[model samples]
Target: MLDHLIGRPSDNWKRTQIILTLLASTYLLFNGRTYKLPRSLVVTNRILKQYAPWRIALGTWLLLYLTKHTDILLGLDAPDPLRRMYKRSYFRGTWVLTALDAGFFTAMSIKPAWLRHLLSVVFSFYYLVFADAAEDKTRRVRASITVEHMRTSWEKAASNPILSFFSSLMRPSMTLKKVIKVKRPESSERAQLPPVQVHLYYAGNLDDLPDQTSLLLHFPGGGFVSMPPPCHEDAIARWAVQTGNLICSVNYGKSPEYPYPWAVEECYDLYCKIVESNGKVLGYRGDKPLKIALVGDSAGGNLVTAVTLKILTHNQNLLTSSVSSSFVMTSSDTSASIHESQAIPLPAGLIAIYPCLNFDLSCWMSPSQISLMRAESTTSLNGKSISHLLESKDHMRHQSPLSVEPDLERKSLWRRAFGLEANHAKRGTSLEERIKFMPPSMTDLKGANTSMLPSAGFVPRLAMTSRMSFFNDRIIPPGLMRAMAILYLGPHSYPDFDTDYLLSPIVAPSSLLAQFPKLYMMCGEKDPFVDDTVIFAGRIRKAKRENSRKSHHPEGDSESVTVRIMEGMSHAFLQMIPFLPDGDRATKAIGRWAQQILSSDDDTKTSMTKSKSLSNVAAIVTNEKDMIYRRRMGLVDGLYAGINEDSS
Candidate 1:
């Protein structure tokens, strides 16, 4: 397993990894993090740095480059040399990466701690840019398709001797059996047929899971495309452990192969299908059923919120039979009477981490502000725009064919993969004129409170002269901000994409928003989407206020929203959990929130179960339709006892 994890390197490569680690560590001892380096190695590294600067620097980079991308030139279908060379590094300790970065600084003879910190920060952030969406189809599909891609390709370790040297220090790709094992752990461990239909992670012993435990139905974030459940195993495991609950991080279908509504519908179908021993859907909690919480991060947050709104909006879309049989909340002849008292299976709570709720700049940001943002220092601080970044020689060499990024001729090869033809605008048409509208029913975007106040809270403090990798503690750089917008909205001008409630929860109806269960939402202070979360939370607050004023049972039905701004953090912080301290902090905070919400559910269940006996009897009488049963209980006689007794 250890050999497999270091990418199953060849006999020679194992020796190389040892050599590189020694060299890198020697460099770190001299120029390492400002900690007290071993005195002897420090003196040795300094002497070497003084004499052989370029030699050491370039050689280290060569080694680093080799370790990072051993299989770089090879096609995705290329055989073993142990699958992907450059991949996620944090699965094991980041020692190799640390050594590589330290060597770069040392070779430059850079001893300044601050500069080195800057370099490291840049290195980590670039992970978001380079690694995030870069390996779209080949590796991404490999994750979803499971072990076959990894297992079939391997023949021997020493395929390319030079590449093999670097391969030993690189992260491992999933093997055929390994992917299936982690992904469907229950199926692997259980002797009997698995009880649940999806991938599940139990906090402890599955048998120890209490009848009242809260189940977190997690939909992971991957820009609605890449990343499957296995990629999120560590973070999910931490959450499950911290919250001490059952978590089901599902493997939903990815996009550009299954776009827009496919992921959405998959998550929603799973939401509708999660069964409890008490005989209720995942989100439906009653007197007898366990509570469930809908949880997601980034694109996943969007999915859970959309699922919530869609059900609240067209709850009739759900069959009534799915709700719990033991406890039906509706008494009036709403859909309940005609539908046999079927109400939507509402999750007890929702936890969204930096959700990208609104893509329609017009709906959420002012036109001038939008223009200013789109035109900001995209090239200065963040380097090139995503479009230009993809055009680079190296980027082009490594890019996936199924990347969601725009392709040649301003065409979207990605859209074509999912059967969406790029809408070619007529020559000379303005961007506004190019947009096609959906029906008003879909586009009017009635309620989630998307109307912008026209005041920009803060645009990032990025300037044209700022270094590409520079950052403050409290803001996103203009370049990263713009690239993310392009990443999510793509290069297309679709007004309807912004207005569709599923794509942008900010456009969901206020009534639908009011129906959301308890919401705990957090955004990083430095995240580009800070304003989005703030604005969306304000909309929810405003909607709750309005709905409360109009409702007779406002206090009982009002939705609760909690907003948090994590200090010194950035967007999609959850993705950083295994690697960054801030990411782990954010994850723990969420676990705390999850614990709170689940505990409250337990309190509600306890109170409901403790309902007085007379009230329970009356509740049964209200639902009784059989005259004989009512008379047997004397409910019918009690109602007309005065007249009947007097006449007798």
Candidate 2:
């Protein structure tokens, strides 16, 4: 029965070779421990192993046979051409015999039931190796023909009948509903509208409220690309509820689809609509004015600042008529030149998180500063002159808020060199040229009615009235502050309009500080932006001095700007969950500050007390904790002893 199952043998030598091959293959299969290698190499070796078993079996048989019968093979290796052919034939025959032996042993290792199935699967793969070993020209030709026929048959079946049948059966199912039912709620508890394209989470009543009511406008930040719907929604909602303020969360248009100017326009449009419809009852109850505030994070901060600037610029009449109260802007980067206007008092209290103010300057220029200048010159000039200008201009003006003097000089030179004087510079030269040469001067600017611009001379008085908060992190490093100062005072003249340009020390805190009467600058001790904030605070104080000395306005007073450094806080600590282990300390502080500002009739005294108290307390607490921790750890003892010994 075993003989019948194995079938007939081809020849004596072939049969003997197959037996020996089986023994060798069995030994290797059971005993060999395949070496492991790198992942890529392991895959390559596995493929090689599949062919190796057959090669080894055939090689062993041929070498043994040749060694046993060397004389007969050597006699046949006499004539040059014939001897070479014989050697090739002998090698080919040996490899073929080895492959068959390998396959026989492989079959023997499998269980009887699986043996037939396994052989069928492995036969085609084995045959490919065997065919390559064929020596006779006729045998090689026949093997190639066989392989081609098998491949063609496989292609036909794979392409048509069997494959097609399975594909048809496996096709995905699609069904359509013919009817739909709408359910209505029995009570007023049902959601009136299904989830829509934009979700707005609002707080506070949209109707008339008491005299102490306030309104918060929240704009989410996603670099003008997407909404920070999930992250900011809860905080904004909670703030509105806790403060008893109405919150209008705007879902502004995004980009690169919408682009810059359009998205900004959309924000302004939404704000206008809200004011038009709900302005009267926004922050106040009686005939008195309502206090409206704007708050946002990251890009949302940018939008808030831009909107506030717009309100001050284009819609002052409406703002002034509706409310004699001040507004608040938080975590914003809308000013075109943060450095220049760092000390400018905002209309209301201004608070900034890790604001990206001066940071945009880097993107506006290259390391050499030449590329940025070239880009600017090319973009500014019209006709065929643009291409020529980019190549010709060696000293490129870098756009930075810090370098006011150099920028002014560059602008003067550009106008004179390009023959761009107001008299000669042609109208409709190119949109680029027109924008370049056009002085930012608006004679009767929409928002500039002299009284509207925050009084430049109102330094000390303004500082007393305004509240500002600045938060930063350790990533902004100290050396970066000095680098920024150099850039600000460097030869490159940065434009005050392009807010996207990167500047040193990240954003310019001074620009905003100088304009607003109330200023609050806070940063984490470990934060990189800390050093910059410190330097900025010093600059603000200096500016306050200059303003006091130069101003003729009675409102001017000379007092140093206020600053705070929060312990263990990061860039956007307020947005963080729990805010602190003690429970959102920053938020509570902000709330208290807001309440005080709203209630206080004397802005100067109110702001002065608040700023001084916060700063002094923060410093004392930080110092005491450091001392206590060091003493507990025994670090203070050794240091104190060493100091005493050195003094003795």
Candidate 3:
């Protein structure tokens, strides 16, 4: 009886899902958040509302029953292993998850404050449990250390309600691997300052390594607000194990509390100290020249790029100030000379994993902002502003052909039996507008005029349905994106959105970017920021070419900038290593690359005649031997004209 009810959709469950969706959507609409969502999400909401109640109920039944045979509705074109794992572990009871998602929204609409709070917690816990299960596949040893003199005034207790609220609710599952407290010598200049905590993860203890070891400075992404889970630690530990290197995971302060210059300054200072100490502070012997690399995902990726640029600019400032050309190495003693501390050098390489580079609020504005801008625009439709009239169903009904369908009689009379024509006259005008506004589908374009179509015309239905590539990500929703932008860039430290290269590294000068060491960037094609990564790689390529020409070496510079776009993956996939085969393959490949960079002789002193571009880097990095999953791979050449035909 249970199998019959759950194995296939019942008439009762179908009605329940539709009713729940409608109720939740109504709740969201009234909450003032629907207007702030991405247009794609808003459009989906509008389309759902246009459907007749009974039709929605019947269609739900059909879709649920049909989709049970395959994972198409999941919209994840990942490997079979990933799909099976996601199905069995994360979303085993699909109905339960769906109900929980709906209940989360509906709970907020409840009248009683106490009951509302209680239901919200009950719904959200189950939701996070199911969602987090996909990434909770590994365990590793971990350690935390507090960096002295790094805290800012913004970090005072109760200074930020946003940070405080999230901290209370989201508890990190931390397992202490080992704790070692090494006090700074009283003679050190920074001994009196407050400490900033940093997390350390590795496959083995410090004793397992030799005197010399490479170190990775890692920044995990949490939208610059929340704390990273243990899965991220597991990935770092795996990398440490694979490369036989130590990994230092930074625990920077979250935004709205620390905001803008706080985290950036903190990361930059810690990085410099690590370099100045020459690996001594991180429990290293500092006998041999230590290789350091930067790795960050999402917001952390932004920090990596920003800190690297800071180093380049700092060195430039020092050069202009008439500092010596040669770098002065600081002694391994607890106290180093001021000159030695200032002479910090660049790392061996830096890796960015689906980083958020562009911070222009206008580019990623919410639907409400778009509506307000449109309402204020000069353009008008029938004497009313375009956006103003667009919001009204009566105005749309008069303009849309779907609302005035002349051939409704031609549709089969049997449509009524299937709920297709049951509420034809009663349907909202939003359905008509959605149909009118949506890009021409494949069916609409078949055998039509080809010459009149725009250069960038119809998008494949799959691209739209597969929410993986757009603002539909559950991990980084549009609402959260809005909050992060307002919090991170709202501060005075990042005043100029157009020219803040430190905040948005993609716009940095070519001369400064040319000074960068080897760069390795890997992002999932399904990520919303995939195109931005492509564009940044192209800019680096351009910088290399320009720098080479300026130096009178017509052949390009050999600064290895590798970019690998994994197919059928999403942002921050590295955190799911071991459980995800693709994630594991990508992580191991990165480990090998890091190992090669650290173990090699000083390649900076040697000059190679061969020029290396993104294509060449891809060939070297994602070779047949590496066995990476890349269905589409190419270089992005042009910058101003946007992505070229061969890009990504």
Candidate 4:
């Protein structure tokens, strides 16, 4: 069986090698045109800019063939850092992902739905095996945040050894570690949701914790269906080390099982428990006050924002002497006690990374949506000169001699040959297509004028691009996103929008937003959620401005809202940290933001920084020369400039 699984190479393999050589040379030749350097210098500085789909597809396929299908590249005789650029490990992983992506796109109906169901099964199994193997070697944590309260029938079943046995078989690596477990809530009478488990990570020994350690509640992104992978553990552990904080990552209930409101309820309950007990739930025995921040990415981002809104709504009702029935307390006694205090304390800040703020993703795009989508391209300028392609005179004087291009016409040709030509051809065919959705509930958001949320039967635009468009993003493609939405929201979609902020936090009223603590959001320029994040930030900024004016609060009195857009990045890039340079940069930025917020005095009349217009916002880019090799090997290198990060 082993011999059969790893088959012998044939003439077809040789033919494939020849074809790959020709294609790789073509890519190298294209890169060559950008510089008038000697032929001996094959590898140059301008390698990361290569963006051909064909090249990426082939590179991934060839990598799989060399590494998995055959042992050709695994032998001792195999070239070290083949071509003096691609590191063995990075090269192997990049290509395998590329091949997997190609398969996933096809399976998800990038071409057609003919074999989608069959391919889905095959790809699912393949992906699970690969993920399990990867996690097997990666470092894992032993600390756990066991749920002592809140239980459901599903949770009881999940804890059954017979049921868990099958689950373990499916995920051997994960099960073997026993890194997580769901326990029955001590008081089953108050159970409203499934069992919730959180994972704790600290830089130092738990016994040696600081006097006043900060707490960061994290939600790892998996489109609301999957659990937090091992990769998140490493990042969170690093964050805890850097900030000296106790980080508890939530293992919220998944979709098609627990779905929409369940995850939000779990998160809110866990948060209340932490705050109400003053971090005792997570084993914190510090003498000083506990400062907390909520951080999440993608689906997790949605959860954090929703929980924050839920807290605001709860506080608002408490002030009005009519606690909303939608808000549920961990217990009847706790609920009664909180009514006197009138509010649960808010977190120091919120850090949302590429969150899907809106669930009412319709088939049609609003005029604003289309405009935002088109804003990234220079091609949309209609006969406008591409003068921005050239560096400023001052920049050119300082640039290296080898990097400079003196000939104007040659420079133009080189730029276009690289990627500018494709950007100019707007009329070229795109994979974007119309997708009808269930009627969106307008009630989900209330009392907010200028809400970014779209309602049912909105006026359709003449030339609208679909929200789920290949031109917009490839990492979280249209089909996968649609599947996730349907699974999480159900077939008819979320019906109770007014109370269900988890469905789409973008629709939350500006009044609620104004009361929100300092919010720090980050997303990739190429992310599908970029438009939603930008719109949400704008709404928050506007609300805070109005509230400050009305209350006559000074400029520094209100907390700042910061938005960071990573150039040339896609959704969920957080998982790539310590691998891609940009990932490390993003992680470092998160640590900095957390420290700043946690250390600052809320009553202080000083503000960190004010947000500027989106146009003027500075974006985070990776311009380091050392990253060229990683970029050339298909690693994320922020080369494209679109929307910028804003700090207010």
Top candidate by lDDT: 4
Clashes of 1: 4
- TM-score ranking from best to worst? 4, 3, 1, 2
Worst 10 residues of 2 by lDDT: 460-469
Q: After superposition, which runs of candidate 4 have C-alpha atoms over 4 Å from their true positions?
A: 1-96, 100-194, 322-342, 363-466, 469-472, 491-500, 556-559, 604-648
Write the residue-wise lDDT of candidate 3 on 213-324 in tens digits.
5777787776676544232554665676776666778777776677787677677777766665556777777565667778888888888999989878976665544223
Residue 628 displacement (Å), model 3 = 55
State every prediction's TM-score relative to the real structure: 0.47, 0.35, 0.52, 0.53
Residue 63 C-alpha lDDT in model 4: 76
Q: Which ranges of candidate 3 are over 4 A from the true structure? A: 1-193, 208-210, 228-231, 323-341, 362-469, 490-494, 554-559, 604-648
Q: List the global CA lDDT of all models.
A: 0.50, 0.38, 0.54, 0.54
In terms of lDDT, model 1 sits at 0.50
lDDT per residue for candidate 2 within 1-648, as digits (tens), equals 334445853456566677888999998778865563467867766666767678867977998978966855545332221221112323333343334323433343356644533563365347547543322322323233332222222222122243334433432221210111122222212225221122333343444344433445556654345443433443554554555554555555444444454444455555443333234422333233334455555455555555545544443343333222112222231221212111111223434443433333222222223322222222221213222222212112313222111122222334656686554333223222233443456433424322211233311111100001111111122232333333323453644433432222223333433443443344443233333344444444554555555675443432323344454333445433231321155555555544444444444321112233234333443454444555554876888889999999
Q: Is candidate 2 or candidate 4 better by lDDT?
A: 4
Query: TM-score: which is higher, 1 or 4?
Result: 4
* lDDT minimum window of 10 residues, candidate 3: 137-146
**Candidate 1 per-residue lDDT over residues 564-640, each given as its tens digit:** 76643445555444455666777788889888877784333312122331233334433543333335448656868
Candidate 2, residue 333: how far the Cα is off, in Å? 42
- Can you give the lDDT of residue 62 in candidate 4? 92
